[model samples]
Target: MADEKIAKLVKRRSCMKSKLTVFGNYLHTLESCNELSSLQLLDLETRFNRFGSLYDDFDKLQCDIEMLSEEPDDEGEEREQFENQYYKLVAAARRLLGARPHQSSQLPDESVASCGDGRSGGFKSNCVRLPKINLPSFHGHYQNWLEFRDTYLSLIHLRSDIDNINKLHYLRASLKGSALLIIDNLDFKAENYEAAWNLLCSRYDNKRLLVNNHVHALFNVEHIKHESCSAIRHLIDVTNKNLRALSTLDQPTQYWDTLIIHMMAEKLDSVTHREWEEHRNTLNNPPSLEIFITFLSNKADLLETLQENKSKTKIHNKNSLDTIKNHYNQPTSTKYTQNTYLQYNTNKKHNNTYKKSLTCPMCNQNHFLFSCEAFRSLSIEERRQKAKDAKVCLNCLRPGHIETRCNLVPCKYCKKKHSTLLHMHEAETTVQPSLPVSNLDSFSSSTDVLDTTTPPIVLLSTALVRVVDSKGNVHTARVLLDNGSTANFVSEFLCES
Candidate 1:
């Protein structure tokens, strides 16, 4: 068995030597040809294939020799000779194949599988195939360097097919803008992929600068308007963008919830701010950024709903008020003049009665003797004149009393034992002639024939009146007399009694 193993190793070594010789001759022939034909190219391709196959065999043989050698002291010289020969042949093959020194060490998948100890020559069944990753493209921004480098190294670096030579292509393809300029300055003929990758790292993989830039960007996000849905969406998008950038910088984001929530909250309107405050108070634990964002979204939805409802309510109220005004103010055709006149009279009568009811001395309604909005709204001089005309006492400004026997203090200006306003009243009375009061009995007899064409004069006064009921009962009542009234009004309580 020992002799057979020795003969097998010798035969394999001789076969490899012969193949190398043939490959060398083919290379010589190709180099000598000025211009290659299709046949020559085909022969070159075949020679390359053969050379690859021989290299795989030599690799296997090298592994076998190391395993079979018991001690370096005994078999070291022979093993060294074989290893030198193998390396020389491999170098020559690489030169012929136009492969760099770094590329020669990488084994293709087909070669690795074929050399494995299995009849089917497949990969180890126990091997776990990693899922392929599609890395995001880098455009020379220093901000993106860390992510791009990490993803590229983790995914592409482990692949056997992407050797250092192929890595050059990938690195160039991945770069853009200033990154391309960086590679352009390097002597690519001398620099390998690792050297170029290290150069890129040295320039852009500054953890401190990157962290500062990302943090600054996060803090300096633009203020968002809170008018529309698009504005709110834009705010969320800007916040998410900054957070994602920070995360990419490998900064811990778990502690950034407060900062992010504050930044987002600053963009809210008054209503949304109140909503956030209420929601935040109800939380047992401090709210996260995501929870705060959800609150804003819900608040925005509610605000939109309320705005729509308020608009609808305003429109409905406006339409109802307009309808009521039109029904009350619009007149009918000329053919119904009598009906219109009668309606006018009825309305006038009702309005007069309403005015009288509202004009109690103590209440602030239309044109009362005291404490009314209309009276207060009048100018000072108008108020004074109105008080004098109504025979209201200047001290208390109440009716049914003259300035003398008022029992109030003397005037401060004239030092007379009268109300303060009595001086102004006397001056005005002196300037204008006073009308003499006609006898009530003579005036009533003269005005016995009432004129229907003219509006009756309204006289407001206090009078003693007799009230008679259907049962022939008579009662004396002190009443407010209004002469303009066409019909007598009896109280419902009195009629019921």
Candidate 2:
């Protein structure tokens, strides 16, 4: 039984060394392929798993050799040979596990030799832990399927560290909404993560369906008038999106390029289309889809800039015009000066006509009584005293005896014997005194004299005159000076004296 055990141990050690050699060669080949195909990735994963199994077998063999070395009956030479074989096995196992042959001087002696068992202290050599992969999230949308599939498979499907059993959990955690629902409905006991992934692909990864949807979306893009920049950006985004989808579907670049260019051209307005055609005509070679998209983007930017500049210029011009109009419409002081001069001339002419028919009482000159410089220069009280001494009737402002003897009638408004100038209240009614037909004709003729022998008329002007009696007594009498009187006559009492 001991020989058989030794034979089994030796055979297992040989197998582990041979497996390690094969694994090393395989790892070299994998590293050589700069980009690994899907088949190569699967092969690599299989090789890594095989290497792990071999490592477990090697660990058991090392334990068996250690057990064999403890047997007392074994010679020192035989024990040294077993130790040598065990060390060789350890070296082979380390190479298979991709561990560096050299030990760091910084690591302690126990840690460096820990791999003699199937562990590094508490850590197991058989359990190869790989870095956890963070899967890309998916919302089950058809558009996101392509990207999600690429990331999901790259991180999970080709990795050896993640077991098939734990794949379902990672897959579930990486999805949400409709995607989660699709996986949740699967029979948990029977269906694996692969089956769930297959279901997702069948539903969302229909290449022909995706291509058609993307093509339809690209064709239907429209440019908004006010949102030209956003519209152009959206157009480029959709174009690139569909192009990438087509490329993923293995559609020919030339075919999809022509199709996309035509679709984009159709979506453009007449002006932009004409401009695109002009640009195309100018190019010696037919413009590629990428070049066309770039040109359109540039054109959109230029249009937006031009529109902004034009709006600013229009506003500036409008403001300038308004300012000019305001400047033109404003009244000038020169116009006010001319108006003042015309008003002063008109008032002077009116004053000259008034002074032609009047005489100053103090100077007996052909000027207004108030226009006499001597009288005007006097104080208010002194002027009043001079007017009183000259027998100026204060009521009618005429040269005569005092106001009591003056024959001035009361105001027509108040019907009281007072000056109309003294009447304060607004007149409720007015009556024009009726003049005789003879007086009316005489006044109308312009050359006829005014009658003096009429009853005292309200608000009419009157004056006082000095008279001499037969006894040589001086008496004052009130008399009305009427321009309409044809002949003047004294009273009967005065005529008899």
349: Cα error in model 1, Å:
42
Which pairs of residues collide in model 1? none
Report, for all candidates in order, the number of backbone clashes.
0, 8
Which residue pairs in candidate 2 have backbone atoms (N, alpha carbon, C) closer than 3 angstroms, thus clashing? 449-483, 449-484, 449-485, 450-483, 450-484, 450-485, 451-484, 451-485
Candidate 2 regions exceeding 4 Å error are 1-134, 187-191, 269-271, 300-497
User: For this target, which candidate reaches the highest TM-score against the unseen true structure?
Assistant: 2
Task: Go through the candidates in order and give the C-alpha RMSD of each one to the true structure.
Answer: 26.1, 30.0
Go through the candidates in order and give each one's C-alpha lDDT.
Answer: 0.60, 0.62
| Candidate 2, 190-250: lDDT as tens digits | 2477899888888888988888877677767875444365667778887788778778888
Q: What's the alpha carbon RMSD for model 1?
A: 26.1
Candidate 1 off by > 4 Å: 1-135, 189-191, 227-252, 297-497
Candidate 1 — number of clashing residue pairs?
0
Per-model TM against the reference:
0.35, 0.36
What would the TM-score be for candidate 2 when compared with the true structure? 0.36
